[model samples]
Target: MPALTVLTGAATAAYSAALVARPQLLQRPAGLARNRDARTLTRLVGVRDTAIGLAMVLAPAGPARRAAVGARVASDWGDAAVLGVALRGRGTWGKTVGFAALWGAVCLAALRYDER
Candidate 1:
């Protein structure tokens, strides 16, 4: 479970880095307008993910790590909600929301195995 948490955190951090570096990666896929405001928002999300991911990766086992995992799950749900609404009816909407929700579920499941 700890290994899974680390792996998930690493993946999240890497993806967030990509998003921060290339907002178009997110915008183009989601059918969002490739504008400055969109880019800024994407970068902000990236930053948030980065922080959460780092916490998951670096926090020790037990309460601190569990809290980080909780934060990550929350973030994923938040993304699912915001993106689901923003991209509703678009082809990418399902994919985006599904991914977020699925990832959140994975993290939620991991919580059971988290050392308390």
Candidate 2:
């Protein structure tokens, strides 16, 4: 169960990073930027993610900690879904930066764990 807790933590961090990066990736899309509402929402999401990442980086046990924790868990889940879809007895590209980046953040956060 404790192992699962760490796995979930990593997944949550990855997912949150993915959420943060998705906006920067879509910012250049012509169709997406055309709609004012879409643009506004995207910007807001970017801001939110940036804020969350900053918060996670700043303090772990603060209010944002729960979100940071969730992001870690969700990220592993998303990656698993991607891998299952792309590698289940079928040849497909399992290439993407989102999950990798999130996993990286998980490692960063884990550095501060007391393991007590």
Candidate 3:
């Protein structure tokens, strides 16, 4: 379970880094307009993800770690809701929403094994 948590965190952190470094990675695929505002928003989301991922990875086993994982799960769900509405009728809507919801589920399931 710890290993699973660590792996998930690492993956999130890496993806966040990529998003921060290249906003186009998310913008182009999500069919969002490529503009300064979009890039800024994307990078902000990246920063948020990075912080949450690091918290999950670095927090010790127990409630603190569990909370961190919970945050990640919550964040994903929020993303799904926001993106689902924003991307409605777009080609990338399904892909974006599906990924967010699925990832949120995965993170939520991991809570079962959290050493509380």
Whose lDDT is greatest here? 3
Q: Please give the CA lDDT of all the candidate structures.
A: 0.85, 0.47, 0.86
Each model's TM-score, in the order given? 0.91, 0.37, 0.92
- lDDT for 4 in candidate 3 is 69
Worst 10 residues of 3 by lDDT: 107-116
RMSD values, in order shown: 1.8, 8.7, 1.7
Pairs with steric clashes in candidate 3: none
lDDT string, candidate 1, 32-58, tens digits = 888899899999999999888888889
Please give, for residues 1-116, the per-residue lDDT of candidate 2 as tens digits. Answer: 33323454444445445645465454342223435665566556555544445445545453455556455435445544655564455423233334545554454455345232
lDDT of each residue in 9-84, candidate 3, tens digit only: 8788889989999999988888898899999999999999988888878887778878888899999999999999
CA shift of 72, model 2, Å: 6.0
Q: Which regions of candidate 1 deviate over 4 angstroms?
A: 114-116
| Residue 1 lDDT (model 1) | 33
User: In model 2, what lDDT does residue 53 have?
Assistant: 50
Give the local distance difference test score of model 3. Answer: 0.86
Residue-level lDDT for 107 in candidate 3: 70
Supply the global lDDT for candidate 1.
0.85
